[model samples]
Target: MPAIAYYPPLPLNAGISAILCAGFLFLAFRKLLRDKKRGKATLSITLAAVFAVATAGLVVGSYQQYVVMNTWSYDFRLEVQPNETVRESLIVPIPGESSLLAALHLIAGTANWSFIETIHGRGLYFQFNGSAGLDALFSEFAPGGAYHNTTLTMMNSTAQPGPLTVWIFYSGGGGVTVHFASGGMVMPQSESIAPGWRLHQLLFPPVA
Candidate 1:
């Protein structure tokens, strides 16, 4: 998958912007009231419009922080032995060695996720469709806890095998869902992500 920018939630940024705009508008209004000059109404309305736009931006930003942040862990290991295909080893981990898939089924059918989308220091991409996929979307330090030192490794058990390039995407939420649900996940740039996720034959690539 190509890299995507990660825009984590930030309520404080919005709040601060709003407070600043309000304060500025208040000052402008006070100045206008004290001035013997003309055009007081025009200046006040201009400041009010600025305040309104700032307030709207703050609200939307806050809402996005609430959504698009739900995520969790699917812990499972793959042992790509000699003469083995890579796709079949798609195993996600479970909590407490518990049945993570089983729990997912309880939440919804067929957990929606992309195939190893862009990998990052935090985790790989996985998005749910409808309600089922939503069940698997956990937040930072989610229920299962965050996966650290997460790396994709490849080994050339044989000298004759050809190398492979696996593309990863930051999958979650379709276009419509993303547009409606407070924007979407902040995916890092593809360049930033490629080096992090790329696993050369038998080794992890260096981080860019």
Candidate 2:
């Protein structure tokens, strides 16, 4: 429904856009020359336009991938205290769904790391880790700022235990704390102590 964005502010994105645009224009001119030189059927300008748009898409996608690789890191864990079982999922969001979700959650120049969905249901607990690195830059949302920190669909989700506590730790050294908007819950944050930041010990009840 909305238009696709080619982020031209970031050097990485801008460079790709410039190159793709140049290539597309070059192709158009070349096609024009061929049409004149051969004196054959008129060249299809429509096809040339489509090819240019496709090239732009490819360039944008590739640049997105490069951004994700150097930006975010995630560590997800599910611990069952009663059963003494723990499951871990560590993911580095590439330029795909995960990274896209992270991009959606980005708070511009403010927060770096953010959690998408942390819910307890069907006797299982789920949590996800998403973050923007210091080097990560933010472009204005395609539509407007109305969607800032606001999401239409959940980014990432996982499940483990119902009566579980979700702990999210963010990188970047400082006296950081997890500030909850739904409720005024604050968890002391840290960069790295000998033990690292202890997120919180939340207790959840099993779903009926």
Candidate 3:
């Protein structure tokens, strides 16, 4: 699948602009109160109002960006081979923002697996080894779709011998759930997901 560029959070300059506007607003208000001339007082009041509005707008935008950066959630289930048993289930607490690379790194770290990045054509994948070797491909959220998804396939090896299937489901509250299972297992329905919840994907070297 083609990787789509993810939207970035509001820049730090936005927050800085908010702080500066707030300072200007305070100064304008002080000037308005201290000035004795009616004309100068009117000008100071106008400047204060403009600065107040600008500060409010920037502060709101910055708060929204902060929320988006910290609130994304992820869930992963690793099904053991031989009988498709769910051996390990983990709810990854993504500290700040949601990045496929970060999530994969957390998973690998928790499982004590070697996380290797493999570049295939124009795409990137994760090849990790635990009890068995596996290749994981995380897909960008579908256009106009509510959820992001990933697929993990077992690599052919002496222990596993063949590829296994993995399925993903997204919950309404902006959480991603990944289920690893055999090909014959039935896929589960997606949970409710919030509309327009943007999840960021970390693509190396960037993608257009």
C-alpha lDDT of all candidate models, in order = 0.37, 0.34, 0.36
Better of 1 and 2 by TM-score: 1
C-alpha TM-score for every candidate: 0.33, 0.25, 0.31
Give the Cα error of residue 207 in candidate 3, in Å.
4.1
Better of 1 and 3 by TM-score: 1
Please give, for residues 56-163, the per-residue lDDT of candidate 3 as tens digits. 776688777666555543433332112222233221111112344344433332233333222211122222222222222333333344343343322212334332
Where does model 2 exceed 4 Å of error?
1-44, 76-78, 81-208
Per-prediction RMSD in angstroms? 14.8, 16.6, 15.5
Q: Lowest-lDDT window of 10 residues in candidate 2?
A: 76-85
Q: For model 3, what is the error of residue 137's alpha carbon versus the real structure, in angstroms, after optimal superposition?
A: 16
Worst 10-residue lDDT window, candidate 1: 174-183
Q: Please give, for residues 161-203, the per-residue lDDT of candidate 1 as tens digits.
A: 4543233322221211111010122112112122122322222
Root-mean-square deviation of Cα positions for candidate 2 versus the true structure, in angstroms: 16.6
The candidate that wins on lDDT is: 1
> Which tens-of-lDDT digit does each residue in 54-169 have in candidate 2?
66776777677656545433322222111112222211212222333333343322222343333321111122232212222244323222223212122124545542233343
